[model samples]
Target: MNVCTTGCDISSIHLTCGWFSSARLINPRVFKRLRYNDCLVNNGNRLANGHTISFQYANTFRYPLSVSSVRC
Candidate 1:
């Protein structure tokens, strides 16, 4: 997942996911969740902004995946 603050540069946020992966981005200022499926090709991915953005995995999976993020 990803989080972008007000006036943040959306283009600077890069995310890559696998076939069984799902991704979302939350904007705290508007309390909205945006689903990004274009990158969904892998599995077991998660993201956190360490402030206003957080998430939870609803189900357990056996596939291994990696998590990464860039500061924007």
Candidate 2:
């Protein structure tokens, strides 16, 4: 899991996984919006994989826009 506070600019983010794992991002700023690009891979393993990425905002009043791209 990753948490960003105070000036954060995630223009391009890359993630590579080989097991059943996941990533999460937590942003606490309400006024500022979060934008990022990501890539996810699972190799060639035929095992049951439950990989995913999620975003959480502390402030629920106004939800910002999030853009992402994933490749398996």
Best candidate per TM-score, number? 1
Over 4 Å off, model 2: 18-72
Candidate 1 is scored at a TM of 0.26
Q: Write the per-residue lDDT of candidate 2 for residues 1-72, one digit (tens) a residue.
A: 123443432323333211211233433221122322223222212212233334443432443233343222
Best by lDDT: 1
Reference-based lDDT, each prediction? 0.33, 0.29
lDDT of 1 at 69: 42
TM-score for each model: 0.26, 0.23
Q: Which ten residues in a row have the lowest lDDT in candidate 2?
A: 28-37
The residue-by-residue lDDT of candidate 1 on 1-72, one tens digit each, is 345444443222323333333244423332222244222211222233432333333335532334334444
